[model samples]
Target: MLEKRFKLSANNTTVKTEILAGLTTFMTMAYIIALNPNILTNYGAGGAELWNGVFLATCLSSAVAMFVMAFLANKPFCLAPGMGLNSFMAIVIGQLVATTGMGYVQSFQSMLCIILIEGVVFLILSLLNVREKIVDAIPLGIRLGISPAIGLMLLNIGFGSNVYIADSNFNQFFVMKDFFGALTASHARDVMTDAYPVMVLSAITMFVGLFVIVVLASKGVKGAVIIGMLAASVLYWVCDAVFLGSNPFASLATASFVPAFGDMASTTLFKFNFAGLAQMGWFTAVTLVITFCIIDMFDTIGTLVGTASRAGMVDREGNMPNMKEALLSDSVGTIVGSCTGTSTVTTFIESASGVEAGGRTGLTALTCGIAFLLCIFLAPIAAIIPAAATSAALIYVGVLMMTGLKKVNFDDLSVCVPVTIMLIGMPISGSIGHGIGLAMISYTIIKVFTGKAKEVSGLTYVISVLFLIKFFLAV
Candidate 1:
């Protein structure tokens, strides 16, 4: 039954291979289980109750989304509350709390309302095939560039040096001179001396693991990324135990091994603030909803296409099988995630790990979903894996994603120019939307100047202008 349903043999894969691939993918991306709540809890100001609620929501929503992708889409993909989206939600909540004089809880609830609205909008778009049309509207040049641009973005994130300074008003890039100066003055000394031993050791650990993974993968070692991450985590734990005398299992003792079901079921479950939404003003609410929808839409499209390309799931014409089902699953995940008290959930690029590991069936997604469900009881253990370990996986994946650059056509300046701009802008701007917007605007301008404006689609022009208004005019 499983063979007929998933077509495992047709894809040249076995159930054992699919299970291994799924486990490998889960190990690489499991850090999100702890990291999501850490980001959403706003440094504990949301209190233990809210923190626990978000943590449970992250796990449950992710599991549900993966299952949907497995059964409906029959693809080895996973979904989670996206990293950039969650950070944006945090910034928006902070703004509302400060400007409207609303408490943190109220502001958070208002943010949830925006996410819910965005999710519903996504559902409508997906059902009507509007999202797929938008994807089709994007020029082949830009579509090809999107993957490499996302690769650069992931690389920047993995390095942990792309700094964005957040103030009371908004987040902005740190001054380049000041940022470089600080890197040289403090970071240089900290790496050489005992002043920040942990920082130095963390860097070393990450690089060593990355090197190991790269070498092993080159030799066709199966699960090399997961093995390297686990090894690096063990090294970090040993260092902490010896140097800092910290108890690795202290959190487990404090929180207990059982899932916090009672707290999760009561607090922040389906807690939308429609009245608070009205208080935020219709304009602000609408703007927030649009922003969420745009970011989530492009991010999902880029990731799905890029990862599918890597997995050999896309045909020569760039059409992916069961793409509508895959897209609908993403939409459903966002709606489920929002109602459960989190940010917009979308398809994760980390699913590429499973693809790399020879995952070719929905059974892989099912295995990953089961792993996320198990995390509800193993949260404490999951929390202990340091960022350094997973950073290696991200960097490795980024390296793999750069293969998309081979498909780009550099013979024409109009195509090459936008692709180049997008490739550089993504990492520097720290936004996939910003990079894509720049590419579109540049493409349109170049086409118009070169007497080929008709080459661009109508929807492309409309989206470019919209992005310009949003990013530059702050509308």
Candidate 2:
């Protein structure tokens, strides 16, 4: 039954088939159970119980969000805790605390409050049609560049599952630390001495999975990526259990449809540090909320628009009708995530993978959503998913996301400069808004200086001026 269901394609899929496809989408995204917890813990906010709560909250919020996006919004996209925003909440907020002497929990509460406010703000803008207008205000070149940059950012984080960070003079990165960590740590030593046997195993899983997909796809295989990866992961586990006498990593393996009650009931939600927000002042809260709202809006819209374009989900009007639902559902997810004791819940660009794998309609999202709900009980088994294994998927998706670059007009300096700035700024600046803001400011300067200012939108000019003032004058 599973195989038959998995063998359906988005282009030819019925509602039933799309639902089945969504299940595979859920499996592919299941890593978030661990990933979200790990990221949020950096803020002094998580433990096993916290992780459980986050998993539950994430599941519930996402399920609700997806339902809206799927059944309510009627769009074929999936929503989850966004990748980049969590990092900001985890790391950037930590910095804010250090500089401000705010308690971590208090700061966390403040941030959550900020997120809630951002959601409300987004809801208002969306309703007023202001959000869409702002999005339209962005330059075509800079707008075109955001998607691939997001993909790159996602690919970078995805690589971390395999590579550990180490201190370095040159803004330390993955390479050197991974090299040394392999020799020093016992587990690293064990994996390395064994020539990354698990990684090798995961590689095989990925290879075999890709092969199956390619072959099945040729034979009209639907859900090829999902079927291939699952088969490979299972094979990887079986080999480990048989040869090693146990699968140490099996605990973290992604599972489909196993709901976790314990995680949900105990999850920390609505536990706001009103006192903390007070200390930060209404100004800070408002600033943070504005920042978050702007970032989340661009981030979510970019993901949805890019994903929809790829999946051919765009309408004849060049607009996806249910985007309003996607935005609303995402805001609700953020509120739920805060109440549940985790990072902000936003749409994931990674859902594009499921769409590419024959996911269309709400069925695919529903399947993925159901799979996420099931993951709460499977927490203990998450270790089974190797970083290297997931990295392959990330890299694959990155390759796909990069395809958006074809739309950029490199020949036009007006377009090329801003696009180039965005590409460089996102990863280096470590903030999507920074990358985009710089691009906008630079684009505005270049166009105005070049006498092509008339082509830019009035709002774009106003926003670009604000970016300059906020970044230079205010900061």
Candidate 3:
């Protein structure tokens, strides 16, 4: 039945391979299960109950979306409430509270209303195939650049922001900025204080696990990525226990075993606050919705195109098959998120890790979705997987995606300039959409200035202009 449903043999995969790939994808992205609630609830400022609500919502909504991806599109991509989008929603909620003196919970509910409307709008556009057409409007050069740009974004996440540590003084540190950037061990120790040892452990684990994955993959190991992550997790646990004298599983001590359905029901379940939105004014509501929509649309498109390219899933023109179905899955997930209480759900770039691990069919996504559902009861166990281990997978996959850059025609300045800008913009801005936007604007400006205006499509010009407004117009 699994073979028939997923056509596993047709995709040159076995059930074992797909299952391994699925678990690989889930482990790499599982951080969002905890991190999303923390960010959206402002580190528990919105209340611990609200945090628990978002936690269950994250798992439930992500599982729903991934299941849709499996059955509707037969794609192996995982979906979750996006990282940057959640931060943006928190910012929007803060602005709402400041503007109208509304309570934080009221402001958050109003934001959920906006997300619901955005999902409905996307669903309508997707049904009309308008979103697919928008994706088609992007120039082929820009499309090709998207994969490499996303690769850079992954690298940024792996080395820069993947492991965050707050010291006794509440001083923050990252792998690249503090550990690698520090001039010396003493300097890092001086600056980071007590957090330096943990930082060192993380760096060692990341590089060593990355090496394990690389070596295993070179030898044609079937489950190299997952194996490497497990190896890394064990190593981190040992190091924490032996060196740091801390229990790696200590978090499990106070962890709640059951899903907090009651908290979810009282806090975010069906909690749309349209009246609060109206108080914020129609224009503000519309603009906020548009902002979320635009960011989410390109982010999804970029991840799909980029990861698909790495997986050899795209046509020569750089478009994926069944894009409409894949997009519909995302829109539906966003709707589920708003209803259950969270931010916009989109395709995670971490899906590339699964692709590299040999996932090729819906079964892989099915496995991932099932894992997310289990996280509701087993979140503590999932949390034990070290952040460094996932960073290893991300860094490895990022390196794999950069191999797509070989397809780019660097001799053409139109391709080189835009691609160049995108390569930098993605890592710097931490947004695949923003990188694509900068590349589009640069590509348009270069063509027009070079007396090749006729080559730029009308839709391309419109998209470029919209990005301009987004960057400069400031709402």
Q: What is the lDDT of residue 145 in candidate 2?
A: 74
Structural similarity to truth (TM-score) of each candidate: 0.90, 0.80, 0.99
> Which predicted model would earn the best lDDT?
3
Backbone clashes, each candidate: 0, 25, 0
Q: What is the Cα-based lDDT of residue 406 in candidate 1? A: 91
**Number of residue pairs clashing in candidate 1, backbone atoms closer than 3 angstroms, sequence gap of 3 or more or interchain:** 0
Question: TM-score for model 3?
Answer: 0.99
Q: Estimate, for each residue in 1-475, the C-alpha lDDT of model 2 and write its tens digit.
A: 4334323343466655576567655655666766776776662264455555555776677777777676666556788887767787787557767877875555665677767776677767777777667767776666667767766765655454333332222222342245433444465544355444444455555556556656665787766666666666777678778865665564345444355456445446676667667777777777767666667776676677667766666654336666666677787777777766666677776676677666766667766776676556555554355444444455555656778788788999888988888887776665666777888888888988998879878999987876776677542
Stretches of model 3 off by over 4 angstroms after superposition: none
Ten-residue region with minimum lDDT total, candidate 1: 171-180
Ranking, TM-score, top scorer first: 3, 1, 2
Candidates 1 and 2 compared by lDDT, better number: 1
Q: Mind giving the per-residue lDDT tens digits that candidate 3 earns over 264-355?
A: 99999999998899999999898888889889999999999999888889998988999999999899999999999999999999999999
**lDDT measured at residue 279 in model 1 versus the true structure, 0 to 100:** 85
Whichever of 2 and 3 has more TM-score, that candidate is 3
> Candidate 1 overall Cα lDDT vs. reference?
0.79
Per-model C-alpha lDDT, please? 0.79, 0.65, 0.92
* Cα lDDT over the full model 2: 0.65
